[model samples]
Target: MSDVAALLSLARAAKARIATAESCTGGMLSAALTDVAGSSDVFDRGFVTYSNAAKQAMLGVSPETLARVGAVSEEVAREMAEGALARSEATLAVAVTGIAGPGGSEFKPEGRVCFGLARRGQPTQVETVEFGALGRAGVRQATVAHALRLLAEALG
Candidate 1:
């Protein structure tokens, strides 16, 4: 089975609801999770916070955190996950933020994605991965895959 299917199976078994907070990948991660049959049993909601304003307004991502580390940083990703969990009735949340593009800076290159996972009664987990110059679509697909894995890991 696909990663998302496995995650939904595990979540349903555990009676866990999941949410997604997405930035660079837009709602792709959410789309992937919901694509499976009967995902409504485990999927709760999704936040497509592509802009800094949306991130702050929707996910409660701190403006200071964005100004300090930018939207693609680990700090913002963690806050996004935590905020999703807070704003929804979900037991678990995953956040993705990154620059998936043909354009990137020397410091924050393209395909550098930050992920955060928050589970009820558990500490939030944050990670940064470098997929190394993958095109925009490629990076987004990879991010969705990684996000699914993160959610599955958290369910465990």
Candidate 2:
């Protein structure tokens, strides 16, 4: 929670209004940010695009991209972040899509999360992280922490 508070402070200092686009973690990333006191000024909105339709309708993620790379890919994550910035009053947006589960295939394993960081007027960045078989809750929590780190690095 202290990390989250410090993150809010960093956003405050930079005047970076934040938005989130989430998938497997549900709204946990947004929940973490909003759980901190005084986050309303920094957090503009959150998009919980749990399904492909929601991703397309809410975040404007491309159907072609989803068809080619699937929902958990960096391509989708990038679109989600870019879409968040496009739809929100926020200056900074973060997106996460992943499989946090007790089951996964050989290609995309459990505890695999993709993240995107988009800052207005700058190139959006995307990355994939393998937390490696951590249970559902652990992976989700780790994803939130890593997303916060990405936000901090972007803020810096």
Candidate 3:
């Protein structure tokens, strides 16, 4: 069984639910969590906000945050996590934003991923990871894995 499945099982045992807000990794994180049997008890919903406007409209991410930090920054990720928690019954929410690309830029290069986690009545936690030069698919997969781990940690 995948670690995500185990994490979901733990969450179910604790009577806690999780929600996901994803970008770059798309809905893969949600897919992974729900892939396990009986995940419906633990996973509440998922948001696939690939665009800044979508993030704002769907998760209540601020336009100011997007303009200040871009779509793939810690601010946006935190806002996404907070919004997901506010919008769902889930006790924990995870958000991912990044540029998983084959092309690199001087500032936000390829394989740059940011993650955020929000818990009920708690401050949102945000972090950034750079996978260096991994290709698009690899970076995305890694981001999904990291997001799952973050969700598990938040659940605990």
Quality of model 1 by C-alpha lDDT:
0.93
lDDT of 3 by residue, 1-156 (tens): 678778977797778889999989889989988888888888899999998888999999999888887988899989999999999999999999998898868899999999999999788999999987789999999999888888777667
**Where does candidate 3 clash, by residue pair?**
none
Candidate 3 ranges with C-alpha deviation above 4 Å: none
Please estimate how well model 2 matches the true structure, expressed as its whole-model Cα lDDT: 0.95
lDDT order, best first, reads: 2, 1, 3
- Report lDDT (CA) for all predictions: 0.93, 0.95, 0.89
Which candidate ranks first by lDDT, i.e. highest? 2
Q: Which ten residues in a row have the lowest lDDT in candidate 2?
A: 1-10
Q: List the residue pairs that clash in candidate 2.
A: none
The clash count for each model shown is 0, 0, 0
TM-score of each: 0.97, 0.98, 0.96
The parts of candidate 1 lying over 4 Å away from their true place are none
lDDT string for model 2 (29-148, tens) is 999999987899999999999999999999999999999999999999999999999999999999999999988899999999999999999999999999989999999999999999
